[model samples]
Target: MRSNIPWLRTIEQFEDEAIASTAVRLAPMGRIDTDTLLSLHLGMTDQSVSTIASRADAIAELAALGSFDHAKLSKGAWRMFKDRIEFLGCVLPVGWLVPERRRLAPGQMASAGENARVKNTWLLSGLICDVETGETLLDRCPACLNLLAWRNLPNIWSCQVCKLDLRSVTPRQSPPEAVAAVRELARYLLKRDIRLPAPLGDLPSPDVLKFSAWLSYFRWLPEDLGLAISPKNVPAGFLLLKRWPTCFDEIVLKRMKASTAEDLAKGDVISRIKAAGTLSSSVARLPSAAAQAIVKSRLETLFGFLDGSSEGFQDVMVPISELVNSRF
Candidate 1:
């Protein structure tokens, strides 16, 4: 359905602080009705009344289905409203209609490197998952199983480690498994919140909250995939390395293989571990206090390849784009 909601970046920037202030601006003296609320808060008008009502009706239906509370319709609706609008906006420009567009919106008026970061954020948000395992895409050096930093590669697809030109390297013989998931995600994003398909198995179609949480973790891609997969209250240090098929060199692998939690605890490394409440703030989202600490200590020791590198997140997203294109 056609939507008039604003873009993802626009809604994301409309802070809660601004909302209250904007509400006050709309009603200087007293409480306002829904019509006034729409006009003042969202810059709506008579011409757009139908559009707003349709969206509200959809949210109301979802609330009826036990998806969320809509009785406190104004505030709850705004949050839900922003998410659906932003997602649908992304769908047109970045997801389904990408082929028809000539170029992505430029990063002009943004500070240095901001454009690339924005683009990568959108790209990462489009990740196609293994519906069963939640395993997303990753690009690796087939020879060494090393994660290829595609941003640093030459025009030719050369492996940084074994120096093999992978352009002619045949893809795996396995069937393309992620195609259905990718389409399902795109359809859910383009349309609105609905029950996910049978293949997804009762996972709620992607919503603002779910997408936002994933986006938070997604900003830190391949390097942080370790965190994305870690479960609540679990130690992530050694477990993260053991859980995922990550790429590590012989020296680093040997160091990781030989190290114990005690060794990690004694290691001298600048830790970024901080309290994040239930937001999965532990390093690599390690839930165990000791695990978080252990992973914090060894972060520099183990994943030193990404240490102090600005290119870690942006450069690592190339594989996702490639994976998406392969399906088409």
Candidate 2:
């Protein structure tokens, strides 16, 4: 059935967030979480919604039912949204990346790079500034330092707790190169076929790029080489190496291997058992052994990139192989 709500139009780059925000406004209590929003939009019970596997399924159901008009989305934009949701997970966890607050008039739609805040996506969570506007995404209320929670507020641009107009706060400065790196990553994620710069474009597939990006977050990798331990600096560091492919050389590989070796050396039988439990808990989504093997192979390919060797090269694989075998 077509949606009876007239203001339920999708915002271009902000489609998911817009839908989420609409769900919150429609809630009788003025606040609703992800599951409740899914149930409400899909006309399902909370229990039934819980059974749904992924956000892509919910979105597809919405599209098929004409809850969201297909004509409103540019063909390319709709395809990218569907592909990203199907391939990656949902938009990265809510509130992980600070968001820019923008006012949306009823039935209004806005595109990316407008003088408004950009929403987070699974691939773009580490962004600090809007690539187009160069505006620093706000993490908290400047007036009260309260963490921003979009769903909890009535007006997205106003801090519900402090009543501060977030837009009035001055934008913080970020490095231009850092902003460019994020823009590149976002573009790559959205349009995998888009020609990219050097080493990123050389990669075989978008999945390989994602696998390498995921490896950058593995806890055992050295802080300097991978993402910073500091939460705030992570976005700046997320694809810093990708922007400079030469940085992934033998020396960097040696450093990561040393770090992995040190971690393995610290573990005991009890620690190994604990690691096994941790792996089991974390990889529940990848339940099959074949799925785990695919991850292993992808990770090996990433190591190969670092050491300038073909996939599954023995010397580089030793450290990661030992770690994975020990944990599993």
The residue-by-residue lDDT of candidate 2 on 67-92, one tens digit each, is: 44533311212122322322233233
For residues 1-328, what per-residue lDDT tens digits would candidate 1 score against the true structure? 2233331221111211112222222221224433454454444544222233235654443233222234432232222232232322342212311211111112111221211111221222344332223333234556787754322222113454677655435432213444444444444444455442222223323322232233334334445555443111111121222222232222234433445433433432232121111122323333234433333333434443235531332233112323554653
> RMSD in Å for candidate 2, one decimal?
10.9
The candidate that wins on TM-score is: 2
TM-score of each: 0.24, 0.46
CA lDDT of each candidate?
0.31, 0.40
Worst 10 residues of 2 by lDDT: 105-114
Candidate 2: global Cα-lDDT? 0.40
